[model samples]
Target: MTITIDRRIYNDSVISKALYWLSGDYLIERSLSDNNTESVTITANSATDISETELETRLMQTLNDFKLRQIVADETRDIKTILYAKAFAEDEDLSEEDIHD
Candidate 1:
């Protein structure tokens, strides 16, 4: 199976994460095009008989999931830092209101 994706729409990190999950069932090869596109080629494991369409669908789904995770992580970075500080700071007397604020 072979697929091409727009680099602007899906970043390298997203592709890498998706490939990591798909690696269990397929041997994935990746390349970049000068036109700002990414090309991915997959060969199913010997024990698997998945079709090209299904593999492409799964790759797209995995890519979407990784993109969502990245968005969530980016959106919550500041909040996560505050949470960590509230949980482990030396001065641990932060009130509920302080933490929320």
Candidate 2:
């Protein structure tokens, strides 16, 4: 089955991450279109009972989930870095209250 995804709605990183989960079960190929869209072709490596519509729905859901995760990670990167630094610092005291703050 092949699906075309808008690049504006889903970036390559998110798509790649989502496709990684299905790599073991499917043979996947990707191509770019002139209209700023990505076309992904997915073929089952073995026999399966899933319909194309169901697979498309699942792929869309997975892509959205990964995009949300990517956004969260991007937004919290600085804060996470600080937290990690504090946790590893010998001179800095990382308290439970500090985490809440």
Candidate 3:
């Protein structure tokens, strides 16, 4: 099974980051439609599919790939707080040194 998800937001920086991922090793652009509101689409094929759960597995993998990239950078720590601070901010009280996720 194959699935594609796309959304066009008003922010260019976010679009640039998402586009960088969309264009993968063998990504297909498929068909696209646009308007003054927002250009977005999804294309998928389950016709010649062999695997029983390929669709679900691949979708989960794709979502995880993006989630992994959304982690805040260490360089931005100065602008915010440490893990401890974040913990406190959220009232969790975790250590900033606990870098391993």
Candidate 4:
């Protein structure tokens, strides 16, 4: 089965992450169009009872989930970085005030 995804709605990173999870079960190929869309083709590695419609549905869900995760990660990157630094820092000056500052 093949699906076309708009790059504006879902970036390459999100699509790649979603595809990585299914790589073991499916032989996947992707191509980019000049219009800024991605064409993904997926084939089962082995015969399965799952229908193509079901597979497409699952792939869409995974892509949406990863896109949301990517958004959250991007939005929180600065805070997350500060928290990690605080967790591993040896200096005592890294405190709540430092985070707020």
Q: Rate the local accuracy (lDDT) of all candidates.
A: 0.82, 0.88, 0.43, 0.87
Summarize candidate 4's per-residue lDDT along 42-94 as a digit string, tens digits. Answer: 99999989899999899899999999999888877667767778787757344
What's each prediction's clash count? 0, 0, 0, 0
Misplaced by over 4 Å in model 2 are: 91-101
User: Which pairs in model 4 have colliding backbones?
Assistant: none
The best candidate in terms of lDDT: 2
RMSD of each: 3.6, 4.1, 10.3, 2.6
lDDT for each residue of candidate 1 in 9-71, tens digit (9 for 90 to 100): 889999899899888878899998766898888887786777778778878998999999999
Instruction: List model 3 lDDT by residue over 1-101, tens digit each.
Output: 23334443223334345445544423334333443232333233333443536644654465555544544443455445554466567764545454443
Worst 10 residues of 1 by lDDT: 92-101
lDDT of 2 by residue, 40-90 (tens): 999999999998899999999999999999999987766786688787876
User: Quick one: ranking by lDDT, best first?
Assistant: 2, 4, 1, 3
What value of lDDT does candidate 1 attain over all alpha carbons? 0.82
Task: Tell me which residue pairs clash in candidate 1.
Answer: none
Off by over 4 Å in 4: 92-101
Q: Over all chains combined, what TM-score does candidate 2 have?
A: 0.87
Cand. 2 Cα-lDDT: 0.88
What's the best-to-worst order under TM-score?
4, 2, 1, 3
Question: Deviation in angstroms for 27 in model 3?
Answer: 5.2
